[model samples]
Target: MRMAKIGLLLDEQAAVDKWAKQENVFAFYIREVLDHLGIPYQNLSKETASLEEIDLLITGLLNESQQALTQLLSFVEEGGTVIHLSDSPKLANWTGYKSVCGGAGYGYTPKELGHRKPVRFLKTNHWYNGEPAGWNAKSGFLVSGSPAGQILSELWTVIQAGNGKIVHCQADIPYSIVGIQQGVEPILHDGEPAPDGTAGIDDGLLKADDGFTLDWSIDRAATETGMKYFSEAHADKWREVLVHKLAELALEKGLTVPFVGRWPEGIEHIATISHDSDFNLEESADITLSLLKECGVYSTWCMIEPGYERPLYERIKQEGHELAFHYNALEAEGGLWSESEFKRQLQDLKSKADLKTVYTNKNHYTRFEGWGELFEWCEKEGIQVDQSRGPSKKGNIGFLFGTCLPYYPIAWHTENNRQYDILELGFLTQDLDHHALADTSVIDPFLEEVKRIGGVAHFLFHQLHFLEQPKVSEAFRKLVKAARANKFEFWTSKQISIWERARRKVKIEGVSASGEPNVSGAVSGANTVIWVPVPKKADLAAEAAEVRYGHLCLKKILSHKQAQTS
Candidate 1:
């Protein structure tokens, strides 16, 4: 077995590279994907045209001289994989595929002019939360039809060349920065068109008729597309394809397969129940708390003005429930706020509610605009997790992040390439919207989806909604019982956050030159996953002394051949 060395071509003369230098969206995204899979990669510079130990070469469209082109072709001829981000004329001609030079993005009709399209896989066309809710788009491709290779995605096509493989992607999966620069417009978050037609942004900020200058950029467009495009779900589409293809290559060369496990301890399914305390109404809180107690589930209660209900807060703490701030009124006046104000409000609530640390929160009304300011303020106030992001509008209530996984929000603006310390737990299903339609059954399908994918079924039940309609309480109790019956592990938001942080810290520390991989780290009481590097023909067995993935709830190992066949 030989070490799998991935070489990333940093083309200085390429336009994409010039754009990435300013934003580094593509490189950053690629690194994120690799990090998620625990695969090590290196940046190949112009001086270093070829690497002796490189197993795979990933680069954008090749615009190099014939000599340089010949070297790459020779590398492929000698058995090496090459993945081109866009249509490569040289590679297409070499591989016997016609590469047409035409601009894309015409005749693609997005179902909704301004909303998120579900992160659908190109091969299976399956979505995480069933029938592709949110938004849809139609885009033309530069390389429409590949004669020999399989089309992994409508935009990404892969072909076997000699002993190697060439994967060419026409669409910008990492189009976060580049798409915006090219004036690629998306629908705003409020289900309205943005000034320049961007998705998932505040309609007020881009108000041109009011004479407000549009301060938006391609970088800002990435920030505004929170749960939509440029998100973890959207990025995972391309990442999964790459990993599957690489695994197949590994199999062909008798190398070990590498992948990132989705859940902690490999648990197949999980649920995190939460209740937002929008109003200081103690009766509704009491009813919901009683229901949770009967169901034997500890939930996170996001409170809005805790000073008004001291006794109830005490009772919640006594009942072993987590207390999180519901900061709405404080941030309601607008997106402007100082850390002092957040600190003062948090301290006042802590002193009144007798809370030790208000580490989590849900913004009142889910107001996340001025998110950059709000998240910075949360860090200053010592908040670790916030579940304020989700679909607030009527038609937008669906899985926005595609999965029920919590993540750290990257601040493209103001943070200078830094992600906020606050982890984002996305809102899945809320009580108000579902209750308005008198349907708690809307969550059933999502739960089923979660079970299949080994994801979290995060539910947001409003205390006021329960008080307004007692039937909602009954619905919740029934749902909890069903979930328990289905073997869903119920978790508090804080517990999930802690487990996520610990799982991310678990990494492969060393890999020998012989291709032996060593992984180490453990999360207390949670299932930790370690990548087992086995030969292509070897049975999936643990190579080193560590926790085996067998103990955890595991999904099927997606092989390259399987991906192509699918």
Candidate 2:
């Protein structure tokens, strides 16, 4: 009952029922979180010999196989790890979760902590009345001036059974993350207000920020360091809980887990600065470009219709910056949200480019209508990355889409809700300057969380705001400095897109406990990261090249001969 890596007891039917049966879609978050965490896993739903070679088994959604359940119980009795998600009536005694309905269904939240509890959040953050606008960078970093309380909803029960352990979750964490990341009733949302500056739920115009559950009035929170941040992205932290538990349980069996680093070159974190060239703000391009040059990093320029003049565009490209599209759907700007309209602006922006190639797009005002329409348009436009899913209002910033890192949106139209080809590079805030939320206090804490989870910290600055607005320019400078403080290297969206697409090609072979992966296809030599997870930080001190996301350690693994030399 115990030999190989973690066995993901998947339920194929769950995907089919995701749209009809709300309970089934809860399983979606588990696979998503596992993928994002970069954990080593084997799917047991289809084409598996037996669980005999598996040490830890995570049962997601419904299980129709009773023989597997009997084997699972026996394995647990024999000291194998079994983690039951959603609700499991048979696992009640081991999980310590009481029946919610007069000894019938499983519980929602844990009544009390179990014997073998995992570490809870180090700091509790919340949203209430917070720091007001006009608080400049010099004002302070920590935004704890406001009163708050606990905002996260995850609760767990862990019990030391037989020779192993049983971990249970009653709140349905995966479902929550999926709901937050995707949306609860985005497609059906109509009456919801445009509080985030995006369209209302009923607007029928699907912007990337559609169906957001994080309330601007309540969900915004600061880091434990005191810097303000979007409390919405806390889902990433919740997902990380599984990463720790996986490694902790595996270590008890004297095994180590391997994972891929979020970035190459052994870097702990990444940052991206983008400028939306609204109405071709060429007048402010020099100042914005100069600021980027002073920071010693390239950026992405998302251009709207009638882009910068050929000369300025040439300079931007010559400087090695990425030139992308900023699709305009604002009616006042004489824009439309139709597919034909999107294609029109895309073609127009591409024509304005020197290279005639646009790989990325961040919609004008982050306009989105449906779940898959924007992604589908991007796919058709040959765009590989998009930054449209973010908050336009200052208060609505920070992981509003439930992640700061780039991810492929799950295509709900598909039977399996398949991941799309385009990468969604969700930005934290647009126009961090603007002379209003002029403070850079939120930068560090956001970076701290990004570093902790191996995620990207992306910021958007409109070119026009860099010059006329003195505080806006100053805010940009402070942001770049704060990024440097966190040791986060700045990259353009193009670089991120290329790296992500390339990173997926890297394959890990030889899946035994020895756990040395025969990796290949790392295009960026010396920069590609291959991570290994040990129980302790000191596990691979001398040989370990770099530490990465989750408990995974070890360093950059060279996949080719050139990589070894470079």
Candidate 3:
């Protein structure tokens, strides 16, 4: 059997089960990763043609017929790759491993020294504690493979049967990625976890709140899913493992796996600074604008409607800063669902010449319970992008969709087969968490991780940061300087929005060597990123590129010099 690009096999019933029977959570993270890599993939149904053209088959919650299994085995034998998820008995049998039954939370350790660095994560399911949280930590069958097979994790094994390899991962990695979980049951009126229940169970799980008061200091479970290793900290490690495996498979077949590896214009990563104006913080705006001007950084200003100093707003626009709406959609007078006051505020903002045409918005207090309704309002109002997807009053400040990039959060509208016209730009870190700590030391690790993953460092610095917290403002300056030192591109919120929109339209063709790869359909004036995976044996001197997390990128250019063959 021969393979093409990547083939994703999803069981119809399994998809339904994981979506509805489980929760509304979809496999967004997996899709995000594929999109990030710019790897084209197609969903394989029962009626789909021969698997011969599929180079890598990622099977998810799919039950297979014996004939299908035989075909997959044949495909593997022909040097194709197969990744099976959770409790696959057939895979266990083929790989000389058996399922071990027990309570959830048992994690895997890298038995092979060669696999240790990439698989630094102890458990693939735990996110916060490095141990299982809540009941049944989403554990699965432990794979006891034969001597020939390599045990990457206690519950995962890779067996070389024929020319191809079979990867058996006994964990619900997809579920963890999508965050399908039993949320913490509210105990007291304050929405704390039930004290009488199991320890570490739902104690620190990410909760959807009405206010932006979720305790960031607490080392809570980032995910309520029983899996421990599926949290934010392990995202980079997992991506590394998958990328390495894919590269190895491609090398074995004497083929190079092409992907859009980095940020647009070949930038390694991006640093986007934005401010949300909500209260009597107009003074903060002046200071922030001054500071940003001194540093030569352009940022975004999201303001609450119905009020603002006209001079300050005009000056922000004069300085080339973006103006965005900071809506309040929560309950009471601030309830965005109420049309009477909401429309009036919208009218007021629209009447202001400086803020009238601002297309981007972030709800005051990060409110998004009625996001669907708000999206409708935004579409009707001609708002193009939204930054409302964040910690909110009740959610964690981690990657909600396992990505720092912008995406269409259309999965929430699956029932109508409708998609929100506005792009969703998720925030990375916020000042709320930093302000709580009175310093930025606690956020250093997170910043490093974002750099490691080459993800967008989208910071949400409130007006308070510039007004009340000088130290936090200093931290912000340091962060910007650090990003510059690290060679990360600085972007205004509007630029990021513009670039992400352009990125969606851009496509990555196959690898080229002669000269700059001509990328068609690129939005003129918008930076377009084209990425290619650098081989381990490739000559570094052959081209001038920025090496980021293994992939080599040519910033602000469209050129790729193929590895010279001896």
lDDT of 3: 0.54
Q: How are the candidates ranked when ordered by TM-score, highest leading?
A: 2, 3, 1
Minimal lDDT window, size 10, model 2 = 101-110
Give a tens-digit lDDT track for model 1, residues 1-566.
Answer: 45467777755455344455554323334445455555656777563376678887777435566666777777777788886665456556666665553332211112221113223221121111112222221321122122222322243355665777665554544332222211122222333434454333344432111111112221121212132121223333334445554554554565544444656543657788788776678888888788888889999988765435687788898998888887654433443345665677688789888878887887666654433566788888778898876645433344444445565555542333345677777665577334443255455555655564456777788887878877777778877887887788888888877767765555554445544445554555544443544443444355332222211111233232322333
**What would the per-residue lDDT of candidate 2 be over residues 1-566, giving only the tens digit for each residue?**
12237788766654455556643354655776666545557877642237677878887754435654566667787878876665545445333444331111111111121211122221211111223342222211112212233222233445566777666543445555555666755453433554554333445554555567655444556545343446535456456555656665676677765666667764767899888887566779998888888878799989888888888988999998999988888887798878899998888767767556678999888787667778888898899998887865554567776677787777663435656788888888766546555256677666766776678898888888886787877877888888888788888899888887776656554334444555645566435666665555454545654433334455535554644333
Cα-based lDDT for every prediction: 0.54, 0.63, 0.54
TM-score (C-alpha, index-matched) for candidate 3: 0.71
Index of the highest-TM-score prediction: 2
Alpha-carbon shift of residue 116 in model 3 (angstroms): 11
Which digits, one per residue and each the tens of the lDDT, describe model 3 over residues 502-528? 555555444455223434445555354
| Error of model 3, residue 280, in angstroms | 5.0
- Backbone clash total for model 3 is 23
The number of clashing residue pairs in each candidate reads 9, 17, 23
TM-score of 1: 0.69
